[model samples]
Target: MQVIDAMHKITSHIRNPSKFSKASKLALQLIEAGSVKPGTVSHFFAILEAAMSSPGACNEPSVRADYQALFNAAQGVTECFNQQQKKQFDIWVLHAVVANDLFTDDSFVFSKAVGKIKDAISALPITTVDDDNDEAAALAAVESKSGTTHNNTDDNAQAAASNSLPDDSTHAAASNSREESSDPFGLDGLLEHKSNKSEKAREKTVAALNRKADEDESKRFLKSQREALLKCLEIAARRYRIPWTQTAIDIFAKHAYDNMNRFTMQQRDAITKLWNSIKEQQIRRKQGKSVSGKLDVNAFEYLQEKYSHEKISIRHAVGGGGERRATQWLG
Candidate 1:
């Protein structure tokens, strides 16, 4: 059977205590013989789990005994292998132990095992083999005790070329000298500085002109839509029985001011009609009729419904009649 299959069988048998003796014997023999592959480290932990879960298992004394036996078997196999093979084996065993959550407290044992493996590998003679050649013999000996082939001549030339570049400190000093010689009072420097200043001034002037043009266009638009928006506000306010205060007129003016071009000609006409109704409602409220505030519930509800379709909230309408408060209503 494949190694992973064997490991699974062993783990299963160990978890079921009736099969513990058979499984434990097989697992111990396989591990001791160093037949487990590095890729099967995960499977090794499965076996460990089974062993730890068996009936009468994980009792401190019994667990410690089993651990010692396993440790000894791994050490024996490690000693019998060549250095490279032994390192691979040790790595697999260490991975298995750690994966199983064993050897967490007793780090000394792991440290000693690592030290022995390192020493064994270090003692092996270095071989000279070029991996880039890729012949069958070289491939077979790839894992043999050997250091990589070194090309000193090419490395030396690369090192010299790297060292030949100017360092940052020297470059900075040279740049400073060039700057000082070009302009003493730095008037050329001052002109260079003023060039940017003039450019920024030009940009600011252009921005101001554009803003003024936009403001004039906005004024014309508001003048055009003024009657319509006021009419709409009046009608909406009166329909909801809300009073038309100066505050209400101001809110309508602000909406006209900000959104002059946004409304259709029809919408503008509707707004003028609404505002006239608001004026009538105000007259009624002043005459002691029971009317709501300047912003009627219906007007608020309309704005809310309209903006909701655009994902805008109506919270801004609470005290301000749905108009942004930063700017004057007509301005």
Candidate 2:
């Protein structure tokens, strides 16, 4: 019989074993004796069913005996095949076994067996078409070229600068207020006597306050930008079927965090303008009509220019920008 026809028969026997008990028994004998050819569908299916099925009262000892017999029969057939073909056959058998529901109840034992089968296949030195080593190597190359070494020095400097600025501003403001309060004379006399000195002090204090506000705003803007970048990374990962790993997420997060200050003023402004344009375009895209030609320009390019100075990775360049990356953790 043809391999496909024989496989169909074997599958029918497995699905309704009691109805084909006599024929199954005879087929089992033929398989165990190695009288049937290797790679015949019936031979493989009979072994697969015996391996997966529960050993009931009438079938228990007979099935066990048949299993050992088939194993012995397979030894000669396996010895005749090349190492690559053997590995391929082993994987094919494993896939079939995994797909069968009969082994689900015996998962622990079956899982261990599957592991052993994989280990044996791995030892065969045959490279499969879908091996992941290439992708892993590519990612490693990108990481090396990206130059994302974390340095605590930059963080410490920023923190020290942040802490010192606020204290200095508060002290200067307090001193000025106290001096102004000490002047007890009414309007004109006090104003003319202290006007020049007070104006100089006020100017210094305002400059300090402006400096502190700029620092605070920059910090906040960096945080918001980082959050948006992460959201975009997650969406790209999902679209590409990449498995989410905590280590990968943290690596990307650290890269984003460390490089936050590298954004140029122009890039930041471009990003803001891009987001504004996106809101307008989204309304048009949803309404099923084109908007102004300016809004029709590449939104991605706009985001790239906005975030380009921040050294964002290609992985984070999707899902309406960084917002998608930030929210992926929730799901």
Candidate 3:
């Protein structure tokens, strides 16, 4: 009943029908049986089924009918959801896309399929809930830090009452009450003195806003950096004939974050270094016939361990081979 699992099975069936026919059939049965509630799950089931039944390789001319079916199903799914839901659904679709290596087919049709899904996702308006929450939290934090009270109902009600005063007598009475409240010696007025406190509060509030702005800028920069790194990694993987997995991607993301400044400043050099290490690992892996052949996983784990221990070796790339206790060297 898991939509992603179904997607994986469907795409696997498309890739190797004979090997995965049972898995694909079971997945379709679970999805089509109505055991799961109808909305998003059903829509995804339709898309999966369409992909499963596709006639030819995604890049081939014979696959047009199958492509059309998938495209129509995706379109229908996109049309049924709001901006937020569509974005979520689009992410799920991307997971399916990556899980099946759909876009790695080196075909315009496969890439176009991905592009269509992205276009559908991009058509939706962006949600501001997180931004709004961040701002609200910043304001609240400043207020708390400044020991400022946010409750203004009484002050607002008082202003409203003054504005609603009907006659001169009522206005005079309100004025007297205001005068009494303004008296420095009065119990309420003692806390109402407009001194440097207001200026200090304003300064703190401004500082908080400035800090929030800086944080947002940092986030944007980090996002761009990560995207660049990921794009470069994907291209490098394709070039090296390596199959990347979600776990590998996650590891790369963490490594990129750890070395954000270096990666951002010299992306090519950084990626080249990382890729060289991976290539070395793959070369080492090929020597042993009994070795597990999950090259990407092994490479990723090697990088993860190397970086985590601050003992990475780039000398292997330059034919300088010596290892420290912390550095794991390939034989």
Candidate 4:
């Protein structure tokens, strides 16, 4: 169910899949809204089943077929979560399915699969919804902050309505009377003017639209960055013949973000650099076991040849009392 577990099972079912190529294909499938169109939970499960059943370590044609199918399915699952605004849900569902041992459980449903997040959301402290009093209080607080007095608008209209008018401007009094009489809340009857309804509605509409656009843009940008990071991780996984879970990739992403100006650099560069450093550390650890008071270069080359497919050549020339021993490694 965890990302790593999914990755392992997936990797085991494919033979040398081109993860970078798959990433490119999946990236293009992203819609203009910036995510893959979501699939139903049933469809997602079906894809998972296909991927799990696919053959691994097959002939070239079979490998490509398996890769394409699995890649498509994986991409589908990723997009399913994303388009639905469920970031990281692909990995979450994988982990959940695994943890619940639901692969063989025919009775499990999608709602149950997704209920964990629902519980978390319900538990959040900010999720407070109550009766109409709370809504009224919220509205009142916002309205109070506008700084315009209720009397400023309708009160003036009322005053105008009551006043004596010269013959030339009789229409102005009539217009004020119509406006005051048209007040739906009857605040004007009390000689109090509320804000302009049409103007306030227009402002609210514009503000809401702007806020939604901003939210969408921010989500798109974040998704793009995360996709790029995931692409790098996938490439690394395939290249090194290693499996990665989401948690592991997340840790890598965290380190990469911390060190690379919060992922402003190309993600592949971080992946490559980190991979090399890790390999160097592993080599050093391995080399640590082979060290003794060593002087027999010929014997060392012999051992290297014996242990590896590649030949190691170490030449010793009788010069300066046969102390000159040169070593060269060839692949």
Q: All models: lDDT? A: 0.42, 0.38, 0.38, 0.33
TM-score of 2: 0.21
Following a full C-alpha superposition, what root-mean-square deviation does model 1 have from the true structure?
Answer: 36.2
List the pairs of residues colliding in candidate 3. Answer: none
- Overlapping backbone residue pairs in candidate 1 total 18
Best by TM-score: 3
lDDT of 1 by residue, 5-111 (tens): 88888877776655655666788888866666556654664565456432123323334445445644656534444333333333334323322222223444433
Per-residue accuracy of model 3 over 22-48 as CA lDDT, tens digit each: 443454454456433434443344344
State every prediction's TM-score relative to the real structure.
0.22, 0.21, 0.28, 0.24
Q: List the residue pairs that clash in candidate 2.
A: 228-322, 229-322, 230-325, 231-324, 231-325, 231-326, 232-325
Shift in Å, residue 201, candidate 1: 39
Ranking by TM-score: 3, 4, 1, 2
Best by lDDT: 1
What is candidate 2's CA lDDT for residue 313? 24
Residue range with the least summed lDDT across 10 consecutive positions in model 2: 322-331
